[model samples]
Target: MSKILDAFLNENLEALRDQGLYNEIDAVEGANGPIIQVNGKKLINLSSNNYLGLATNEELKQVAKKAIDEYGVGAGAVRTINGTMDLHVKLEEKLAEFKGTEAAISYQSGFNCNMAAISAVMDKNDAILSDQLNHASIIDGCRLSKAKIIAYKHSDMDDLRTKAKEAKESGLYNKIMVITDGVFSMDGDIAKLPEIVEIAKEFDLITYVDDAHGSGVTGKGKGTVKHFGLEKEIDFQIGTLSKAIGVVGGYVAGKKNLIDWLKVRSRPFLFSTAVTPGDVAAITRAVEMIMESTELHDRLWENGDYLKAGLKKLGFEIGASETPITPCIIGDEKLTQQFSKRLVEEGVYAKAIVFPTVPKGTGRVRNMPTAAHTKEMLDDALAIYEKVGRELGVIN
Candidate 1:
């Protein structure tokens, strides 16, 4: 590294370490299931975003293996080029059906999906009214749009309405869009889409909802937009294939025209290599499984409720989460990091989430209970939480 660059990196690295903000990443030894092996210790995992546990499904694995034989490994090129495979078309079709939209377009991942989709449509002349606590992807995508971004208080409909009205009345913007996460990942609060839609209509604003965390966990696995019955109302419905779908891509589900536009305009779709045939096939299978039955979704909720109850009983502040994602809030950054370290030491793999991810002083160890976890597993994990809580003075 160059001298100036090396000095800059060293300074920031030391700053993060001194403040207890540097995170130590542990490599999972095998499959990222309910039980994870990290550093030779097998622990009950509450750290993954695999809400439905389809990532390690045996049936999906076989499907992917079969796909490799039929369609080969790579997609060959980008979507606009020779990269768009039949499997790609099939996955997008499945995605549209899965999200209950007229059509859909896929991306390499959820984060880039946001970046590509947002910048594709909005520009400097337009304005994007985003939720304050929207995911980092959404925040970055909005910035990339080059649009004047106005942040509304998270899920606060009154503030959203006021901002929408102001943006519309100002006439300073040619097109205005209101964007929010269908499910706020940190707090697991469902977005006020009904009210947001109403506000959008009142101001003729375009609506975008990134239901990345809500798919397969809400709306009986259809997603948050379908959960609210606003499939026809929201212009953009973005989601991740990695989360509940348990694959490796992202997509925007909307009207056929919007999908068509994204196909041509979204930079990732135009330039990036499409998902591999094996992964695309697996993703389609996962979506089909989710659509076929709510058994997994129901099981996930049951597990979430059980874990939340256990954590609350232990006097940890499990934030207001309507969905399965549970965050055990610890106010101080260092204590939260130490708390997570202690949990891992005691045989649980819940990691600490701190600054820049969430606001300062609101550090937490977010717990994700999936459909694959048994009651026995959750009970064991809860027992670990209790032991750690008492030892760390986080609970009575």
Candidate 2:
């Protein structure tokens, strides 16, 4: 390695250390099931995105194990070459049906899907009106597309409409598109998809909704598109298999032509190896479970409401959230991180999200209460939070 590269890394590391921003990874000792063993201690898990508690589901595990027995382990090659296993095809078909779309295509991760799908159809000559608080993957995808990205105010329909009008009238780009996350992960606010659809229709803007957090959480677990009843209006619907699906991968669901175009053009889909057969089979089963029953979904909401009510009763500032993803807002970054550390020490596992991940000083302890959490578990977590808050002088 070059001496110059070594020096550059040293300088950056020193700066991060000085600012107390350098994070040391904490390894979980055991399974990521409902409860996890971290630092050799069993804790109430409130940090996982396994919303429906399907990550350790017996049926999903069996399906994956069976596929591993038959298909071995890896996909062997890129999809365009030879990695397109029957399992892959069937999973995509199931995803399309789940999303209520004509077709769908899967990627290695939700992050990869955003990068692949955004640029496959858009180019430098195009313009994109993106929500200010869209996910990091979407922002990176827009940048990679080489499109003129104009950020509209978060969840502000008027701002989106104004920007769309200006971009359309300029005629400087070949096409215009608008994109937003179906649910803002930080604040847990659902996107104003209905109004966005109206704006897209009026201005002929292509619509994209990355429903990473909304799937298996909204519209009886059908997702935001179904929640808003805009199955045909939105041009692109993106979701993650890693979240509620309890597996690893991402997908784009839309009209048949869009799916075909992405399959031919998306770089990750064409260049990277396909998801393993085990993952594909497991995810297909998870999707089927979601489609067949509302039990897990109901339990998730029940746990969420219990936690939110408990936090509120304790006088914690929980922001304007309409979904199960709850944030206990703490203003200062250092204090927020300290609060998280204290919680972990006390046996609760929520993490602190600070500036850059969220806005500056809007730091919070993000809690993801899953269906696996019982009322007693939530009560125990609330007690820990109360104790930590009082010890830290954040609460009485």
Candidate 3:
């Protein structure tokens, strides 16, 4: 290794350590479910985004296993080449149908989809009005597009309108687009899509919603775009299969022309190998299951409401969350990290979010209530929370 590179890495790592910003990755010993075993300790899990609990469903596993037996494992090449399988085409068809769009295109991961899709359409001459708190993937995508990105205040429709107007009126670009997360993951707040749509209409700005955490948790599991009944209004309806869908990969559901363009032009799609057969199979089965029964979705919401009410009653400042994503707003970053460590020691495994991931001074402990969590499990987790809260002097 180069001595200069080693010194640079060491200096940055030491800075992170001194600031207590470096996170240590803990290996989970068993399956990730409502509860996960980390370092030989079984903890009541509140850190997962597996909302529908489709990740461990037996049927989904069977589908994946069957695909593996038939199609081997990897796609073996890029989508534009011989990597495209019949199953890939099938999955795309299912996703488009699920999202109620003209056509859909899939990518290796949700992050890549954002990176691939945004740049596929928009160029440097264009301008993108992005939400201040939109997912990092979307921000990176906007950057990759070379579009002039102007950030509007989080979910502020008026601010979006003002920026969109400014971007258009200044005659600085050819087209303007507004990109936002369907649900802000950090705050668990739902996006005001109705108002956003109205602004987009007013400014003729193309609408893009990255619903990575919205699908399989909202709209009877259809997604946020459908939840707001704006299926036809949004230009790009983006989502992830890894979360509630119980698998991996991401997609862009939109007009057929757009899908076709992405298939031809997107760098990741052209360069990266297709998703594995097992993941594709499992995701397709997950979609089918959601379409068939509301059992999981209903249970997920029940747990969410239950947990939210429990946290609020405990005197924890659970932020303005409308979904299963909940955050215990603890201010100090170091204290928040310590709190999370204590929670894990107490057999609860929710994680901490600090500066950079969230704004400085707004450090929080995020919880994700999933369908797999029973009331008994949630109650046990809450008991641990109460114990930890008192022990840490966070609650009386």
Task: Find the candidate with the highest TM-score and give its number.
Answer: 1
TM-score for every candidate vs. truth?
0.99, 0.98, 0.98
Q: How many Å off is the CA of 95 in candidate 2?
A: 0.8
- Highest lDDT: give the candidate number: 2
Give lDDT per model, in order: 0.92, 0.93, 0.91
Write model 1 residue lDDT over 56-145, tens digit each, in one string. 999999999999999899888988879888888888899898888899999999998999999999999999999999999999999999
Return the lDDT, model 3, position 14.
92
lDDT of 3 at 311: 90
In candidate 3, what residue range of length 10 has the lowest lDDT sum? Answer: 15-24
Clashing pairs in 2: none
lDDT of 3 by residue, 1-396 (tens): 899999999999998766657777889887899889998899999998788988888888889999999999898888888988899989999999999999999998999999999999999999999989989999999999999999999888888888888888899899999899998999999999999999889879889999999998889899899999999999999999999998889999999999999999999999999999888888887888888888999999999999999999999999899899999998888888989999999899999998678997888999999999989999998998999898888899
Query: What TM-score does structure 3 among the candidates reach?
Result: 0.98
Cα deviation of 212 in candidate 2 (Å)? 0.4
lDDT of 2 by residue, 123-216 (tens): 9999999999999999999999999999999999999999999999998999999999999999999999999999999999999999999999
Residue 190 local lDDT, model 3 = 90
lDDT of 1: 0.92
